[model samples]
Target chain A: MATAAYRDIAIHLGVDAGSELPAQLGYAAALAAGCEAHLCGLFNRPCLPMIRHYIPPEVIERHKAECERAAVKARQLFDAAAQAEGIATEWYDMPGSALETVLVQARASDLLLLSGVVPGDKTARDYDRETLADEVVLALGRPILLLPGAPKPGLPKTILIGWNGSREAARAVHDAMPLLQRATQVTILCVDPEGQRGLPGAELARHLSRQDVAAELLVHAGRDRDAGSILLQTAQDRKADLLVMGAYGHGRIRETVLGGATAYMLGKMELPVLFSH
Target chain B: MSYRDIVVHLTLDPRNAARIQLAIGMARRFGARVSGLYTVPPPNVPYYMGEYIPTELIQKQMDEAQTASVSAHTEFMATCASAGIEHRWLSSELAPVEALRLTVRASDIAIVGQPDPNPADPASVPYGTDVLPHELALQAGRPVLAVPHSGSVTEIGRRILVAWNGKREATRALHDAMPLLRSAESVHLVTVGPERKGRTLLAEITEHMQRHGLRLETAIVDPAGQKVGMALMAEAQARQADMVVMGAFGHSRLREMVFGGVTETILSSMSLPVLLSN
Candidate 1:
């Protein structure tokens, strides 16, 4: 059988997905260099709606021009940075309807590097930032390597995977394979889990082992703490470079909307997150 | 890593023939043992009809299912013989999905079909029903390659597309996809939207794909800021690629499934199969 590894990677650029361009762009470039793969930057520009018939043509032209400026600006910045790193890179930029474009591109990308948001931030739009992250994750059908502002740079030396025996979590574990195998240590953290499936984390651990990922399974009580908070705490305590887990929301997974653990993690993530749905 | 053992769900539908062919092809490629987990569901009887249900009718129905099971087992053996691969058969009277789940060891990668959830389809099998592939992937503790029931694919992973991002999940998926890519004629690595500007991830991906001897080319597309999912689908179609390979979701299926976004869009609309690791 032929062995495989990543050949491509994508990063979200623009004020919409990530405002801190240098940190993420620098990070993505370094990642592309690490993998020795070509890099592609999509400079997306957020635009105001421009299809109104009653609006003056000049007004529409002005709006279009404004959006184009943003695209040009983002592209120029991306180009300069990509070139400085001496990386083979491509650039894509457009105005308005960026979310849809990004999502569609996600279909083709293996991993999407997105900017994580701090929880309780005003709506990224009319919606919550975490929910928006969910939309990106669901829409992309790709693993998301999410980085917060001022991301702690470099590959994850220590990783934490939140295990709950859900399909999403399983996907996350499998998706996180490349990083997990590379990491010096991996901890399977199960928080307040009922352990519904027999040998809950063992099989997953074995699966990782087969990939040469030495993992330790740790079950935490999660006493008086939400699963989201507990997971964050564990990641911080472990000094993990990456956190892997499934994004959960809606009735599609379980009945309780309750706390919206996945959403919380996306909003206030402390470390880079590798999420698989 | 190689999949040493593969378990393919065996049912009595016309599609099982194609499924078996694909599984056998994989077995041959990987030189792995293929186990046909044949399942026969008990006749559908009411939930709590104690004495009201007629015994003879139920018995007759059960006998028919058992007969079908025997036929399936025979087919499996024949197919295995023709393929000249190491094989085994394990048939059960338990509900097909549950039975396979129970019989399957955690280490074995499962091969199954994604039957149309619509009950109206003429080709649909009663015993082997919808969402079997998803359930197996979740329960089997192993990767599940889901072939849609509506179409047939004789070979898989020949000319492939690696939808890559530098995330660990994508990284993991790339590793899982290696066995298929190693033999592939071409591997296209692509990313959408803006570039991550992360050099380490891209460099590593190039080195790894090259090491496998895959004819690899990486590109970035401007979907002109279109819905990323549509952009991705268009790219896949444009290439005439056999399948699109990538990690499944970066979030839980619960919220994303409800919103009915990109992953769902691809699952429903993809003309080719998708190799999803996460």
Candidate 2:
């Protein structure tokens, strides 16, 4: 079983200032962390040149004031959310690029909180937001909690482990230990096993036992199915609300060649999966 | 390309049987050939006698290992043939990565099993050394598809997630993934962090893909108050993406920033399979 690297959960609240998702996710983090959640707010400062361009030369003296005013408003909103959750809150104002600044701060936090920004079109510009999120994940080396719209009432109860005997799987299991320990039922499913000797599920079961987390291991031997399809089926059969496993395989150069199981699950599995590399 | 000619690498340990079967199934799907390579320990000499092991003795052991490898490959190919796929087998003493790399060099792809699930346990041997998929990826110079020791999969490539950052690595990944992206029903270009001014790199990628007739959607996220890695995971879930494509970011020896903050975050905490290019 793995523990999250960080104890603090940092929520990146967009400059929109009024979005409800940030607060909702904040409350969820508070509940998940119990005593460990540290809620913080970050404001995206416009680049100095952008600010200069937007404001007239005569009003340049007020530029600093305008930035401060926005920061103050963001702080107030973040403070309000923290107060509502009855947790301590911190605030910071970032300059230059929002993603870069947020990433820098994320280095010190345990988990990152974000709100999904839907692309208005399929064009390149629309991909900016998605690219930024992916970049943060690829660049930061931490886990993120995305607030789709609103936060759910509780953490996942039924958990699924995508048992692959890979370093990534081991790391994912370790990362997910915190959540797995609290889940009501845990299932470790191995998709294909015509001749394999050992399964990851058994190891997970043992790890859970040490932690006193109850879990069950299931080995599904599918002769011809892809690993991903098998995992999705097992998750569905087990009624798992969350899936835990290692993010499988990669291609040589750039393309991600998902191990059959991971690729399939990503495509069709609706259950939430906790993954780590 | 169809999987018919793909050669998959198999670990010597019997524990990878499940993964091998899954690989055979994939090969079948693509009408590909299947080959199993068994890696053996490097030969050692006895110090007392100051003599090398006899060639006959080595041959006998090699023969036995080859028999087992053939048996496994044959059984797997039987399954594939039954499913109407053409398949074959190859056995060699090369390291698992080297053997598989050679087999697949002129072929289509290589599928390697993940190491044992419990890496902490010393006895497991985690795919017997030569099968470290990451190491293979670094050296293969060809595409390597990694399969988890468990889990079943048949078809691949559907909803694709492109982890776009305006970087050379990201662009390389996009270029490598053209085949999958071209066939994908929907492609999501996910960007993180704060807003950027002027023409963004992600936009350029989107335009390029659009020119290729790919159906795509773009998303932006701010890991405000949260770790960037976690935020991307959340977004990947929200998009319901099957696979993520990005550049393998790391700094050169002299460059301390190696794998910037976001790249490091995603690699350590990635929930989805990320394709990375250096």
Candidate 3:
């Protein structure tokens, strides 16, 4: 049987550094408890621009104090949540660049959980939320579960996988095996532009069958409609709690030069999305 | 994961029977259905050379290939029947590597044989037979078990030694081998390198395994100037492991070919059955 479990899960806590437990943490803890995994909370010090000399000393001191306080609060909240969930836990205070430090620390993690919500506060000053998520998704070499803006009450029971017969798509499907095996229902969505194959998703469905996942296949015509829109519409229509798809891109370029569906989903995802590059 | 769809590639080599028996044993253990794949060699003569060759000679070659394919199929079916497991047969005219690549995606694992170091009749060996297993391991996106041609491997996965390094390929291979690891009588995660780095990586992986209800016997070997592949094989033999599991092609293929990588060393010098995934 496929191992429907993750042994190590790490959550990004740098953005939600307030004195409260973020929903992603609670969700991560619950998942850890379900699989007996060790949950690690990774919080990196806030990144400030190098123009510190031009800034006032008092402002710098105030920012430093706030960051120190946030770190302590985040640790306490993380510990309490883990205790509440009753799973093994670890806390790390990363003291370097945000993305690099998190990557170095979470190298061995099976899943890295990050919030998809970028703070809308105009006055907020911290790491660049837009690029951080993209960088991690591309460079982590592990699966990333991007949480919705609002937390769902429980874990995902229904999963919709986007398959396009590409290497990235194949990797995403395989990496999402643990979740797919546990989902109550799985629907494989294949957007065949040419509609050449007699049955679009039969091969992948057969492959999943060997792993004991009975999935329904949904094939759609690409006639004039963009793939990203088609996927998003299907996901919404089906009320899928989770979307599993490949985070497609090369280097620092976004979907403009590469995968349009990935960019669309990343920007407008209403449900939790699991992405593997 | 437990493999339910198992594929064994059959050729005309003498070690073909041993490979079939190994697949049957595995199917019996995992409750899997075996599929015997026999790929017929395409016409040796190119289109340009076709006009120069005699039609009678071409017909004779085609007849011989058909005879070989039928005999191999018969033997595979008989072996599966006596073993009392579900089985299927697939014959393709595609090249051996391409056929296995397409067929293995739908299957859980592939059972292939190591190339014979010296063939009794080189002419009889099909084209691309020697490099089939190695190429499949790198490009097939599935775990492949290559049975050594020299020895009779009656028991596998009983005692497994995993060659570990904290790299992406190794992590993938370890996860793909979980089904076998869970059932093994004993498993050892062996790493050979600097002491501190090895110990830390082993500790993390050991903890991960512990969560899966497996207690791994850990080892950090001192290479002492020995090559990584040789060191790992020596340790597996010393520990009496029946099987070896490791990643394939950690470096780029071109770089490995030029600089001599660990994966090449193991593939050429392997004595026991090796499970490899990339």
Off-target runs (Cα >4 Å) in candidate 3 are A1-3, A15-21, A45-67, A96-109, A117-142, A166-168, A223-226, A247-258, A261-266, B45-51, B117-125, B195-198, B250-260
Tell me the native contact fraction for each prediction. 0.08, 0.00, 0.23
Best by DockQ: 3
lDDT tens readout by residue for model 2, A1-277: 3222234556665444334445454554454355345555656765545563576766666766776776776676566656666775556677767678776665444456655432222335324443455556544544554343343435668888766554455445544655676678988776655646455356446545645467787877764335666666777777776666554333310114234335334424334445444
**Cα distance off (Å), candidate 3, residue B243:** 1.3
Writing each residue's lDDT as its tens digit, candidate 1 over B63-173 gives: 886787788888889989987988888777666667766444433467776665455754345665565654454454345666766777878877787776554345445
> lDDT: which is higher, 1 or 2?
1
**Clashes found in each candidate (C-alpha, N, C closer than 3 A):** 76, 77, 0
lDDT of 2 by residue, B30-79 (tens): 44456555555443334554565689776775676667566676666676
CA lDDT, candidate 3, residue A212: 80
Model 3 per-residue lDDT tens digits across residues A1-277:
4455777888887744432246666777887786568998888887656684587778779878877888887877778779888888888786767787666555467788876542343224323554676788765657788764545535578889987764456557777777788788899988887878577678789878777899999998894246667777888888888888777665432343224555545435547778876
CA lDDT, every model vs. true structure: 0.65, 0.55, 0.75
Candidates, DockQ: 0.07, 0.01, 0.37
True contacts kept of 3: 0.23
Task: Check candidate 3 and list the clashing pairs.
Answer: none
Off by over 4 Å in 2: A1-6, A16-23, A32-35, A46-77, A117-126, A193-200, A219-241, A245-275, B1-41, B45-53, B56-278
* lDDT (Cα, tens digit) per residue for candidate 1, span A9-85: 77777644445666677777776665565677766666555455476778768867866666666677667767767
lDDT for B232 (candidate 2): 72
What CAPRI class is candidate 2? incorrect
Residue-level lDDT of model 3, residues B1-278, one tens digit each, is 47777899986566779889999999998889898998888656655664589887789888988888888989999999998989999988887878887667656789888876677866556667888766887666677899997888897999999987655566657877878899999999998776554356677678768877788998888888988888999999999999999877634667466323677677778899999876
